[model samples]
Target: MIRFGQLVRVQDGGEYGYAVIGDNQGDYFTENFGAKPAWSPTSKGTVLNPNEVHHRKTVVEDQTITLFIDGQQILSNTMDGLAKGIGAFGFFKDRGMGSVLVDNVKVTKITPERPVDPDNEGVVPVEIKSSDMTVRLDEAFPRVLDYTLTNGKKMQGQPTKIDTIKINNVDIVPEVSLEKVSENSIKYILKAINTENKINADLTILLEVKNNTLEFSVTEIKNNNTSQKTNEEIIRTLEIPNHSLVSVNSSETNANVYGAKISTDTTVNGDTLTEVTDTLRSFNSNYMYAVISNSKLSASMHSNSQYSSGGGANDFVRINPRVKEFESYNSVGLSSSPWIYHRDVMFNEQTLELPEAKVVITEDANDDGVVNWQDGAIAFRDIMYSPVGAESVKDLVAYRIAMNFGSHAQNPFLMTLDGIKKINLHTDTISFTKRLW
Candidate 1:
């Protein structure tokens, strides 16, 4: 079985946040994408920040939920399960702001899976706290969900379904592009593959085509591993040729190395009462990409022992009030790298690890593979999602090494993980294989 995951990242002034890819049962909260704007935390209110995308970034800590925008603590409160296991990090739009981009989201776990090797590849979890967390949660890249936007509009489909834009009857890896069209839209070219075994075409894959979407096939061969066993090898990638299908990009580029991005498009009705997205690259793997717009994302680790909302004695408590609301729009909220990373263990022939049905590599195994609950516990993928903001995007994307992982639900086993490095996309489009990492 192969496990996949990423690191947690904390944004600075850009107003962003994200936890390592894992679970979010204890991690629950909501906020306007970027509405309600106040430079201070609110005990019972929220401010409004006018950004393209507005959503509520709620981090339900063991005892508090602090809202942040542009690295500014706007609102905060105490909650019931504030100090528990954090699972997700993404955006929540009640009805403010408009089309925003959430990007540069990743989740990596430092807390090594129990019984893991002492000398792991990537970083390991130092500790889990609820008050002034001693460990850096920001650098972890933890997430429960992912909403990837190329420029300012939809690049894939919904966060639940990956955009299987096949190029040549093969599954296209992301981060690969076709062309930088008109500087307004960068053609994110994709290629597809077909097979039951490595390079074998045993079935057909379905591709989700949205507005101005196209599907194609691959003409060359460049994949290495068809699957992995340990969590370390689960997220292993197979670089493509010049016509590679996985070379994706963020709306914003840090230095062709690390940063967030949002593809160009006119579908973003953020200026209206609608919020659309294509969380294409969100599931089935440990790696992911997110989009962050003129907004912010954040998270906080409090000490489970003695943590407060900074509101004094009774101020650190949570507020469940019913206030007159306006159009589905609040003010600036908080979140982090909008992403989800999960790990599963299978002695052999895992669910997604092997193959099933649908899009590219789905399947009908001895156990069956469905997304709803009750999918059985046979080493499948974990689900993590979150909201990526300008701040969170700045912390992760382009990191030299990053990864994540999890364990089996019924067995007494643990999975190990490793960090991937030198990952790059072939922006040239003509010869993806020639591109250097």
Candidate 2:
């Protein structure tokens, strides 16, 4: 198929062309006759069989082109800079492939409706409240306007900024929409456009309030531009600015003051110890949770550890938390690398649905009657190990032994007994008698 005013030529000589050929079983190509040929296998061999009447349908919508064979979609390709003029369709057969038949050709034009305008036009802010916390959302740029706990403690600073979304090293400020699912839950739909590369990104953010915790999830990220030939990387970041808390604690990092410390002297070993603050700290690793606290309350951010592994050095999915100064106030937040790894030279299109991360606000996370960094570390351990029951030290030792013995000898208890009896040992003198049991 070729757009109107596009020349149809043989063997990579046309301006625009799309074709499905059965020469090598079955495969399809976009821009078949151009300098860059985008070809993909259907994996269904013999798409066009001899002595058969087949129904083929092709639908073009903006940059997306979909081909359906007998009501089953065979391939869908999205390219950049496709001709928008009237389309022209044609059929062709190779000289040595014998005669071909074409019939019942039909063409239908479709006009898609524009997206509905948001209710508030982004002028007014939307609020979702629960018994323990209240969250305000800015519909203009789709960011948290205010996050306040029930005890009148605010989690954010003034003049909030929009979250960052980068594609191919370019920052994209997306159009935002807010949908209130319930009194305690809301969804944000963001559509970011990269005009330089002609790419569109559809992102979904879901926020829910459960008791004293706020659950935030980047549920879906779709790359609408399915250009297999282009190289792209996406990064989604959520930053909570102007957080006043100076103390930081997590399992992955040491306890330190992220911002300027107040002058509070403490007597340690009969010596006065003055509070100290350090420079900016950045922890880049697979973190399950991090807690920032003050004298009264602590806020803990939890992530799913299973998705945090990068599997190799070249590709990574990490939870990054940085502590820095924003508007002279201490700030801390979480950001993630590319969730989808397209390391192969020729990568396929992907849609990623990520796991949700939870934020808990409390005065004592471990119920230790104090609000401190230890409470935060205890909270992290609880969230990490609660899913699986507690393991004893002996059980852990046995597990380590089994791991060291390799897969063939996995039962540590049996292996230990056998070793004591010299069952598999080469020395016949070191045998244990039956009465030794």
Candidate 3:
């Protein structure tokens, strides 16, 4: 897991010692695991500045492994079978804005080498498109439903049965299609329209599924018979399980399965009833859930614990007044961390003292009441703003090292500045002070 400059590795169930690569004060070598520690590790490096390049290398021989930064050894340790076997290496970064880079990486194999097949190099050919285009929800990639648009143009999509919803007193039917685009990805297309009815509009949605996540592009809305466009394309992403299908019961035709009603910037028929999404929900033998994370019936969440709304900043801030505080599901609201960070900073900077409440590095900050984004944001703000003094610098470094789990690139801040706010309604708390608006 990663946050800002920090990188952690738990090899062999952490018996090989958890290694952290980045921190505010600098890189370090320690056997720290589990929670974030408060004090500094004796073996640590200097602070890492953004865009500042540093040469890092690691060598493992027998039971000993050493880490070096800029030609200087920072950490070295010996453990039983620390360098024993082959394992997969992966790089991970948390949400919002953190990254890692590797250049001119050279690996030396001291162990025996295995022979490779020279005949074809054992490389499988990339499958561009799947020819098995049968329409089924349980199949590989299904073209499940078809619909006729307001222009009488028919399109297909992956939903086993297209759901329907009434908007502006017009019945709109949805269409879905899932296609296998490559060996590792599938393409999804969604459309909604009203045929020979009071409403004359078409919504086109395109998405790509890679691994366990879904990447959604901007939705296109064409006002039929008019020279006006209601919705523009925008990029959005969500995480979901592969081999899942959106299913809606035929009985609940008018019931909203996953769609949320949001006011659009564009107007249709002189009415600003344009912005919204068609509902998409997953189906199995046991249960059904929403594919779009921000939907009331959503099944997945972002790394920052925010619902994955498809697009448009307008819909994100609108909080559903019906949902109660303790309700885990069906609560529609924008995440309150980085989105409101600037306001929180200003509010706290004016009303409260810096570090008003105790900020713990691990999980919780402020020692207020609970563990949430407040702690994460506090730690992140220190790194982002660069508080002065040696103790502040050390605290920043310690915070980075402390965030061993459940951290994101954005939306974490110190507790004093962090508080709750409603997204749909405007306030100093939930209002987005940045350019995101």
Candidate 4:
């Protein structure tokens, strides 16, 4: 009879464990979860005696086992039992000179239905409705949006493996604005509101691999053909701090060419080093993504060195997940460069109306450039993000000017966007000033 892994999965032989009693008594949950009276491994784990009561319950105290064979290769200690392994079962007879028997070793794997620590599982999905829906692009922003998941257990963590954030049967054209961000959480305000009473949507906040990513070309993969696939790219995903104040600063850095780079700071949470690419993919670019993985020791990493080590509590940061990184390979669009600003802007669905103005208007605020509809609309948007104050108007105007014109304008006013509301855009300075009636 032939045997395959699927065969076992379909018809398992049932659970099997190991148990032995004598001067030393122990138990193995299954052939895969083996244990011995006086054995240990170099790996890390704890040994559970399950109590000195030979076969009563699982408990133990100060009893320690420095199991060794031929007075060498100390298998494990009381502090490392979980890793003693599934193979090799034995008993320590008088003075560790007893008849010890090992067993038929089997293999086992555990599949978790849920993820841990801010994984996608914690934040369930929900469908948005019409009546409850709101959108914020220009003047109005959705302050609240709710959804229900498969399970109602109170979960909290970062979302993972999201299908999509949809609406009206069509996938939502994801447009996002600056949501309420705090020291420990970042709530991205979506552009659309959900009023859907039925169905659930796993709302995914799209985080692009910043342009500051360690660049990799198609050639990086061993079997991947590079010359034929010039357009192929590898976007690196960022690992955000578990608990920290996530904020973006627009201040550009000279770190590398390719324009402005976003510096994401999670200071509120204890984070030693920022970007950490465990292994370099050896990209075909001039610049290499720095790999400063472990935050354990004071030794240098990014410059060049082997892996840093240490585990458990009181350490810097844990190693990133296994099977990750290489698996998150995605093609990046050029326009998706990283941008760190005071507030994020989302895609607008409709033309926005200008906010009421306080400045003396002769209703003659025509398109001389500064007093037109376009400028007014721009001014209004600036005001929304402005801090409430008399000088805020000027800052609004300044921001509007900056937002409208390229950063290289000499005369800020002439370069700023003023005439917005009055007309449809034809050029950078075109606005309808004829509505002076």
Best by lDDT: 2
TM-score of each: 0.17, 0.47, 0.22, 0.18
lDDT minimum window of 10 residues, candidate 2: 1-10
Q: Largest TM-score belongs to which candidate?
A: 2
- Provide the global lDDT of candidate 3 against the true structure: 0.32
Model 2 Cα lDDT, one tens digit per residue, 1-437: 11111122233234344545544546554444343344444434235666776777777765466767778776776644344335455655543544555677777777554333223333466777899888776666445555788888765412334445555446667777878899998898888787676658787888777776667777776767656454543333322222121223222223332211122245322211112123332222234344556566555555542333322321222344454433333344544323433334353445323545565656676676777655655554433424443443323322112243435545556666676456425554442322111
**Predicted candidate 4 versus true structure: per-residue lDDT over 1-437, tens digit per residue:** 00000111111222112222223222122111223122322222123242322111211111222322223322223532222212222222233433323334333333223223223333323322122121111111211111112232111111223323323233443344443332212233344333332222222232111111111111111112223221111111111221100111112111111111122344442222232232211111111111111111010001110111122221222122111122322111011111111111242313221111111001112335332222323322322223355553443322122232355545345333344432234344432222211
Candidates 1 and 2, the one with greater TM-score: 2
| Cα shift from native, residue 278, model 4 (Å) | 19
Ranking by lDDT: 2, 3, 1, 4
Weakest ten-residue segment in model 1 by summed lDDT: 298-307
Sorted by TM-score (best first), the order is: 2, 3, 4, 1
Instruction: Give a tens-digit lDDT track for model 3, residues 27-116.
Output: 455342322222224466645666788876666544455667789887776643232344333333434465667667665655423222
lDDT of 1 by residue, 202-265 (tens): 2222222122222221222333345544443332222211111111122212101111112234
Q: After superposing candidate 2, which stretches have Cα over 4 Å from the reference?
A: 1-124, 157-159, 226-288, 305-317, 326-328, 334-355, 380-394, 399-437
TM-score of 3: 0.22
Give one clash count per candidate, in the order shown. Answer: 154, 0, 23, 37
Q: After superposition, how far is residue 200 of candidate 4 from its true place, in Å?
A: 40
Per-candidate local distance difference test = 0.24, 0.50, 0.32, 0.21
